[model samples]
Target: MALLTVKNLSVGYHTRKGFLKSVQGVSFSLDQGKSLGLVGESGCGKTTIGMALMGLLPDNASVTDGMILFEDQDLLKMSKKEIRQVRWKKVAMIFQAAMNALNPVHRVSEQISEAILAHDADISEKAAMKQVESLFDLVGIPQDRMRDYPHHYSGGMKQRAIIAMALACHPSLIIADEPTTALDVIVQDQILSAIKDFQNKLKISVIFISHDIAVVADVCDNIGIMFAGQLVEYGRIEEVFDAPMHPYTKSLLASYLTLDKDVVQLNSYIGETFDLINSTTGCRFCERCSVAEATCSLVAPEWVEISPTHKALCYQCK
Candidate 1:
């Protein structure tokens, strides 16, 4: 059975003006010890989906519809107490902006120990400290620096520390939302490598959310592209990267500069953004899609399987 399955999941935020739908009818599954990449432009509901899965959505936001099934348990139906138990023990998250996520007032060791204690009550303080030290070592941070505050660490080290905290509970699933953002390429690679190494060693599943298609393409086994609160395409990473059927996916790949194309220019790329507040019954990408036809504006596309385990939501593909 799949480790995590999210079906017909819809989420929205309540604004002063009105309710704004952010994620609509999104569905996907991940198997044990596998990684799925969630990629999209900003405001496409990538972070919202991550927050929903972690049960950390803001007060203004709620799961308006759908189910999040993790190991056969429905997360949407679980109570706050039940969800609390499930979190960190079964599922953990490494949030975006690691610097802000870490507490400025507390020592890093205290923060990590808190996570460990929450998951395993029987663990002694000394034992938890030892485990925290091990985690720091695992994530390539110096063990002696655990007493330092969040401000003491560099951007990359802070990210590493966040990863360490996420792994403190040894959860089965880790949802990392843009964990390498704003870091140097070298530091990003190191963080990615460390994450992959830990995932391999611990046999953990991951949902890595990022706007950087290149980074996601490198780490994920499967890729799911989101556009305007909906999944446009999902398939094996290689298949999606090599032969993207969706116009949005193709555009994303085209925007990237590869080694083969040393002086790549994006003169043909479309520049349009979808208005999320306007409820559109038709294809969300129709406004921005280069290949959009008249039918795209009239009828919503159904997801059609193009190859084994590959699906695209486009009338043209159907």
Candidate 2:
């Protein structure tokens, strides 16, 4: 069975103008020990999906429809206390802005140890610290640095610490939201490698959220290309990338620089984006889509299966 299954999960925020649909009918599944990447442009609700899965959505945001099923249990139906128990114990998140996530005042060891103790109350501080040490080692951080503060650590180390915290409780699922943002290229590669290595070694299911298509493809087994708060295409990374069926997905790849592909006209999808607040019927990506026709703007596109494992939310492309 799938470790985590999100069925038509929709999220909206109450804005001054109207309710903004941040995520609309987003559905996908992650198997044990596998990784699923949610890739899209900023403000497309990639992070919102991750936040929803973690039950950490802001007060203004609300889940309007759909269910979040983790291990066949509906997380959306859980009470606050029930979900709190599930949060760090079963599912954890490595939030964006690693530096800000850490407490500058607390020692790295204290913060992670506190997290472990918060979940497993029976575990002593000493034992929790031991687990933190192991996690630090697992994420390739030196153990001596555990005693230091977040400010003492470098940017890469800070990210590693955040990853370590996410894994401290041995959660079944980890939702990583833009974990590689604002890091040097070398550090970014290292962080990606660490996430992948531990994911394979520990048999952990991961939902990696990123705007970078190349980065997502690097660490994820399956990929979901999101746009305007919906998944445009989804399948095995190779299948989706090699045989892209969504115009937005193709545009994302075309915008990405890859050595294997020949130099092609870069499709810079510049211009006005789809209106999230008002339009609810037509396909949101139609305005920016390269192959969109008159019918695309008039009728909403539905998921068209191109293969058993591959699908696209576009009729024209299919």
RMSD of 2: 1.3
lDDT of 1: 0.91
Error of 1 at 268 (Å): 7.1
Candidate 1, after superposition: displacement of residue 49 in Å? 0.5
State the lDDT of candidate 2 residue by residue for 13-42, as single tens digits.
Answer: 999999999899999988999999999988
Range of the 10 consecutive residues with the lowest summed lDDT in candidate 2: 262-271
Q: In candidate 1, residue 71 scores what lDDT?
A: 91
User: What would the per-residue lDDT of candidate 1 be over residues 73-174, giving only the tens digit for each residue?
Assistant: 999999999999999889999877556889899999999999999878799999999999999989989888999999999999999999999999999999
Clashing pairs in 1: none
Q: Choose the strongest candidate by lDDT.
A: 1
Candidate 2 residue pairs that clash? none
Off by over 4 Å in 1: 267-272
